[model samples]
Target: MSTTRTILICSGKGGVGKTTTTANLGIALARQGAKTVVLDADFGLRNLDLLLGLENRIVYTAQEVLAETCRLEQALVKHKQEPNLALLPAGNPRMLEWLKPKDMQAIVALLERQFDYVLIDCPAGIEDGFKNAAAAAREAVVITTPEVAAVRDADRVIGLLNTQGVQPVQLVLNRVRPKMMSNQEMLSVDDVTDILALPLLGLVFEDEQVIVSTNRGEPLTLSDSSSPAAQAYGNIAQRLQGEDIPLMDPSQARRGLRARMRKLMQTRIF
Candidate 1:
């Protein structure tokens, strides 16, 4: 077994596909044979379980574990098909008022002992929820879109993570539209990376299949679906495993975008 790693998947703003990234990444990691557990730190507004298609099997939640009503392991809902993956669902949202970061720290420590990777799906914004989610993570994956507001929020979160001493804070640029970039209506991968100035984990193109998969309660990376988003997610998972997979292009002009991101990854610069 490899050493355990706890990662917080968060964004400064909502609707940037943070939960989607966490769900797919967790499944992708599990598909690679890692014992992975995704914890929903969003409290009352839990959505990770739904994304993983395990919402119906949630017999217990993180709140129950914390309240001593159930053991931590008892609260875990195993993936129906992916044996190596499981979910720790969020409990009552009202619990957030009293939940502290140290409590999260303990839960993360316990989960790390049993899983190779603990992925925390953090709530949006820089509030108590974000602090509690980021508290236990040694590494953070900030999710953002190409819009100026999202990028600015991500930069703020990154700065906050730095202040919290989280090392190797990586960025996952999501919902990239290639055609818009070509028309100069959207920021290019280079534009986003230049402003963020962080190590690039991967980039996901805007794919309608992602929405379809989520609606079907399935992960995009579960099969060789050929969805550009699915392929991008697979590459991101491989990169997370420290593999040297080439960055993918999520646009109609696929090769160009891939080459640009590939060059950036190799050169460690924008």
Candidate 2:
């Protein structure tokens, strides 16, 4: 059996942090001494390169590699800070018209020979883009927020993944607001897992730092930042490597937030 783990990071709906998770998770895995490459399969938007700060460095893409105009080594853009991680840029949006499952498989097959992990950043929604991305993946990570619409969409995607024979699909609940969840405002983690019927991989809190990092074209895991989302991504990477780490509880998180707020107020008062 091939040891390369080709995982598709997908979400059935947009705006659910799918690309963000892919970028962070790729960096996290690389930091842990894994040879990881993130393949940008979202040809329409192709934001993975931007998120990884390799947008300007992309001279060629998977299209050129497959067309025999350029070699695979010429097409891959390695991360400047993290040498262990590299990115395979997606083909032009026009490739979607003629991109077959075999073409995706061919690309992934080439990648599998060199890397320990191939993280495919799938396009959002259950459409042609999603189908093409899922075609080459051996496993999948389904990202969803705590919103009802996102969860509903995730459940449908899970069913589709099952039909496609993707094994051991996991869920990562992103943009979770502990206060709202504790107050019965947003859907709880259990609510989502119950509906999707997949193992919960990790829970990322709604952090403002995520926006700051993305705008700066840096992943939180790249630096030793103390961001909760960064830690969550790292933990998710560790769990993916078969490490035993405890999941963070929303109630505890809420309490920790209150404590931090109290400490800040007291510092200002004193």
Candidate 3:
């Protein structure tokens, strides 16, 4: 039996920041001295390597390791800056037709022996890709926006995860705009939690810095960035490690935004 925490990072709908959360969370966990490996289970459209800036360094993948063509260490692409973290693609996109749930299980079983955390970046939707990813995961973090459709889809995904015996499914509400939420223009945190009925693991506010970091192949949490999203990711990682950190307050976030705007005006006037 392995003590590794195998967690699947998934979202029912596309463009909900599933991969972004997985990438940043992996870096955050590794920075805290945990041996983490992010397994890109969305191999058919995998971009986790690109996000982590390890795309060019991946000479092999889980497919090669499973096929006995390469060693697991050879397939693992160690992060250049965060050596405590590694990235492993599930398979080559062209050759993923043969991938199945058992294959995913096999790959993860091997990973569990060496890593303290195995974060699987699952493909969007409730298709075969999702089923295969869920098969190997002991727990999951379902990402969603404050949109009705995303929440609906996440609810369905949670049901599927339950059927698969994935324990302790947690929720990560992404793309949160504090102003909109406060103004009732978007779904309130309470609204989402009431629908999903899962423990709120974290809240990621909408930030332009996330786009900047993604395009540069550097996750926001990889550095000492003071961005709200970065701080939120770090806090989430702390909570995952069983640290009793309090969740961020949306009202406080809105007030903080107002203060920043006021400071900008003062700086320009001076």
Q: Which candidate is the best by TM-score?
A: 3
Model 3, 123-222: lDDT tens digits are: 9989999998999999999999999999999999999999999998999999999999899999999999999999999999999999999999999999
Cα lDDT tens digits, model 2, 159-202, are 99999999989999999999999999999998998889899999
Q: Candidate 1 lDDT, tens digit per residue, 9-69? A: 9989999998899999999999999999998988658888788888788887776787899
Measured with C-alpha atoms, the lDDT of residue 131 in candidate 3 is: 90
Mark the 10 consecutive residues where model 2 has the least summed lDDT. Answer: 92-101
By descending TM-score, how would the candidates be arranged? 3, 2, 1
Off by over 4 Å in 3: 256-270
Reference-based lDDT, residue 51, model 3: 92
Q: Score every model by TM-score.
A: 0.91, 0.94, 0.95
